[model samples]
Target: MPRMLDVSNDVRAEIGDEEADRLLAGDNAPGAYDCTSCRTPGNTEQELTSTVLFVGQETAVLAFAHATCVPSQVVPVSEDQLRGAVRSITGEDTAPSYAPPVPAAAHAAAPHFPAPAAPPAYPAPAPSPASPATASHTSAPSSHAPVPQQAVLGVTSGVVLVGREACPALVVEPTAPIVRPGSPGHGDEFLQLLSEQGFAPVVDLSRPPAPNPGWSVLLAMGRLHAVLMPAPGGGRPVAWWQAHSPMPLSEGWRGAVGRTRKVLIYAAAAGTIGTQPREDQLRAALDRAAARGALVGASMPLAGT
Candidate 1:
């Protein structure tokens, strides 16, 4: 059986003519699939399907989409994001985006802190309260009530697979095992602390929730430069982690993130996933944490550097 396919030169250059021909012959391609871009149904036998490649530091994921929804192109992503996508496709447990129940006594026992100084200006329009539904496409920051910080989070960039799909993801590893700001002897409670405040642990990225206000990942010239934290009091996005110099990203990473306004974010309890060229190592570390239920995640829009 023959199928209508639009394999771009770039894809052809990477996958080669033999594979491309195989796809057109319906020997290797799927009959129907969810469009990588729109997440809607697509039939390769009925309509033209674009061959999209998601390239990361260590792996490449080939996905299909409607020609109208997404032109064939290579997307770059982090290992963590790719793993999440894989989970979604593989039917792994996807945590609910809603905040989990917290004991009233726990909240009552929480220590109080002084109000932070007035915050700075966020990028565009103010953001709205988070909903587990669709992500907000607006460039504006969220307007939710401000949340205070206790520990600093260290972030790394990579791609993850939801299933056979791939997308860019940010991996957050704390500089130190997270403890309350004033407490010096507290144990690692980073993921637990965020969970208590409504941040959910995401094992799958197929149906991620809208990002909470103030968190963003910045890419420039195909390099990851900073991870912006929400400013105190709903203020501007500030760099929670900025490279001493702009760090180059894996091939196609910036483009992958550019094509998709959304990016997945994963956080571990504490520990360095290592550095570049070792993204695979980082992926393994985070994977262990995720397996042990020590990870939290979200999908946020890309922000300017």
Candidate 2:
């Protein structure tokens, strides 16, 4: 028979005062709560709930009860024990909340801005002709042709073009993703990409470290933001992006293309970190970030690349 996994520590740690009370109150873990004293289940007869009493910063006591369970049978638990149980069961830390003092000067000033101008009614340009014979060319072409055609190149160009056309319409707003320093595996690479894209990468290290098994990265472009985290099967990180404002794509991101046109190429060159990411996944993540007025990009190194 396969050896049973050790759950004693996990159980002990996860069982907070509240959870313990619930357990004693015969609150169903999900379906049925068992009564240790009378061998009776609680939730079967009524709903069960719990209340928490914070004793200190790191400790809390909990009380639990089923609608049918007697008030006299409730058990008390310490905050430390309760927190430990939560960690063991969920593998997540309970974050503490801190309130910062507001600046006095911020409230003293009234906001001011220039008056808005009337909207322009410019006519749309006619479509360009494919053949030079029917086209009126005002500018001379550079001696060198553009970069060779490649699937990755095409994808990057498309992203840049979208940003350029959409920016002018006030649709795209540039934003950056929040990243923690010293995260394992390809975090530096992700940061480098953001810097190249003209974003000032900010690192927040105030919180305790998490068990980051695989690589994660964040990127942002105007109105494009993304957060890429590790997938369950441990391949490439998943990307999530969103747009921050409601504006037409054609005008929202105008003038941004020149700065970002080369970014996708660099990201593609970086390739997928760990296991290669699927094209759809990357595109989806980019789209999410772009929509949010930020961009989050990440790359994992393949073997020998």
Candidate 3:
């Protein structure tokens, strides 16, 4: 005789009709399912059976029973959650039907920062250095305008604010680090952010000296660029930029900036640009930079600016 198991609503939610049928048919001897209530397993000893009775086009009653064990009350789950369960059973890529609630402690720990303010008005271009009167007199083009200087802060030992003015970017204490990569907390936050941004970051196993820790950006400008690290044997260190194409920076300025710039841009883009250059205008400036071929290590095709 097959073993009978009692499953809660939560377990039933996780193990859809297909898997439940398989389990009742003796396909999975040792398996688990999750539902709103809790996780359930099919490891008990007794004859098992399952049946799906439809209530309507969108609703159904799933029943499971053991030959010797009494069945519990059935529970209702949303159609979307049921679909997700089916995907889970079929081994397909589907978002989970449920997410654990956020802890209040986490909300209290990190206070959310507000958005950034607008940038200052465009400043007048500086005068060019005078050429010797004795040298050949040639007319310089008046159409050329000086590129606005943008200050970028670099964070090595700690966080540095970038842009024309300093702003609250990220808190990075070299002395008291809470979680590093691969840690439970770190992986959770990383995966959450990645999913939100629709990006899949690849881990680089290359040596430390390699440019930008082997980090590459897929810019919206229809190009790929590598983020270079600070130079070795350095004097007045600077990060290097190489373009995969001559695409406009405005189209994908996010991929051009270093880690600090990327973070700031993301913050601003997420309606959090602080009281300096407004987020929209700052993005515009970045776009202009891309248009002028300022992005480093980019050599891909340029698209809409």
TM-score of each: 0.45, 0.17, 0.18
Please identify model 3 stretches exceeding 4 Å from their true place: 5-37, 46-71, 93-305
What shift in Å separates residue 71 of candidate 2 from its native position after superposition? 33
Window of ten residues with lowest summed lDDT in model 3? 133-142
- Residue-wise C-alpha lDDT for candidate 3, range 97-142, written one tens digit per residue: 2211111211122111111111111111122222221001111111
lDDT of 3 at 133: 15
Name the candidate, 1 or 2, with the larger lDDT value: 1
Q: Which candidate is the best by lDDT?
A: 1
Return the top candidate by TM-score.
1
lDDT of 3: 0.25
